[model samples]
Target: MRTRRRFLIAALAAGTAFALAGCETLNTVTGLLGNQLNFTQPQLQRYLNHSFPREFDKLGGLVSATLTNPRLSIPSGDNRLRLDFDIGVSALGARDVSRGHFALASRLRYNPATQGLHLDNPEILAVDVPGAGSLLSGGTRELVNTVLVEYARNEPVYRIDSDVLNRLPSGKRIGATDIEDGRVVVRLQ
Candidate 1:
């Protein structure tokens, strides 16, 4: 009888552990079954890495700003996507060229009203202009923000189709999002 009890306990523990795994594998599988995104890390990375550049170009959001070496990392202990990309800027009215970079770290949450993921507190984490140390007078970050705002004003970063948006309850929304153990997990109602 004691051995049977032990076996039951062991099975329960294992089930709980798998349910609480840090990756989105299980979540993605369940999500897909429920008509939601199968948000695995590789899939998310590939889609974002491909889509963002084109969106940026279409918006003409960043004036004379060209992006390269775009990379995305899921930092530990943070429920946000950390995006890093190198930029080329036409300085001095396009006469001189400069190189810089930007980082966007923000919390991901779903807004039921829109039924879309929202990037909270998005900002440019860093900017380094080569050979133009004092030109902007420490306002490089500010410029980056301005450019981002323009892009956001015109289009959302990620959005679900209207048909799907209409199905979700307006008052119910995702409570949290996290990327850990190589998975993107978003809490859904």
Candidate 2:
């Protein structure tokens, strides 16, 4: 009986050690795959701005809204960008065809694992709609950002080249991000 108990305890200890070693190996693998990365402003604009119309369309569809003509711009001397778009909001099951010009101001963020850029703290900076006036002006700003943007939770606003993204995994991490003079500078690793 004594010998059997000793064997059981030894087996349990060995199993625990193996599990810890597996975790350590996983960490090492992550470290090997990670890297430091950088993205220029022009590079960002080429990809981000060009793709805005399609991506914004997806974002609007999440809340049953229609977004068109998304234009991305970085204001001079500001650490944020404005996403100007035409939005058609439909509510009340009947789907009213409300359309207007709108702008969203957002700060930028990054995720190392995916090597993707994210727009954070999006706010409606401007809105123009005929006849409706200010009634729908401020009400849907927060809701559009928080509820309609389902892609933001898991997806990056934009991703780097796959080769670069794979290199900058979570193991090393994103170091810094700076937006200046119509450029986005990102430091990774």
Candidate 3:
């Protein structure tokens, strides 16, 4: 009888262990099925890299500017994304181009219909032209803002995959998007 009781005790312990393990597995699976989609900084940078070297002509094509080498970063403690670019400016007929650096920060706006992320409320952080101090301070700032607005309106920084969205449960969709923990997060609801 003692031997039989020992065997029953072992079986009970084994069953409890299996039940605990099953609960853990279920928790992990539900976590994976949660309503969050994350895009890392490198992924976003890859998309932005393909949209670079945008050229703009103003003043009836007399003044021209080219924005290239887009570098993206998320500033600590801030919810905005920053983009730094190499800017080249020149007259329409001039061979000499003034080189500068352009920095801008903006919030991310996601359009569910288009599955695209756009730069929202972009503002110029800095416009640095080495050895040409204050050269791009006033009128040039306005011109850069114009180019920024145009770029923000027409170009999407990154696009969400429709296939991924389609896999979500029916009637659920992305409700909010933000820059968090150095990642672009799309929260579904």
TM-score of 3: 0.74
Candidate 2, residues 51-131: lDDT per residue as tens digits? 644323223353345566767777899888777777665443433556777788776678667667877767778766443
- The best candidate by lDDT is 3
Model 2 compared with the native: what TM-score?
A: 0.58
lDDT of 3 at 19: 95
Clashes of each: 1, 3, 0
Poorest lDDT segment (10 consecutive residues) of candidate 1:
54-63
Tens digit per residue, CA lDDT, model 3, 1-189: 999999999999999999976664343234237876777677789788987878998777777779999999987778888999998877655556788898999988877656788999998999875533333334567778888887888788988666666676777777777887776777778
TM-score on alpha carbons, each prediction: 0.58, 0.58, 0.74
Which is the winner by TM-score between candidate 2 and candidate 3?
Answer: 3
Task: After superposing candidate 3 on the true structure, give the runs of residues whose Cα lies further than 4 Å from its correct spot.
Answer: 1-32, 112-114, 130-138
User: In model 1, how large is the Cα lDDT of residue 57?
Assistant: 30
lDDT of 2: 0.59
For residues 29-91, could you state the per-residue lDDT of candidate 1 as single tens digits? Answer: 455344344355455555456555522231243235566666777776666677777766554
Clashing pairs in 2: 36-188, 41-183, 41-184
All candidates: CA RMSD (Å): 10.1, 15.4, 11.9
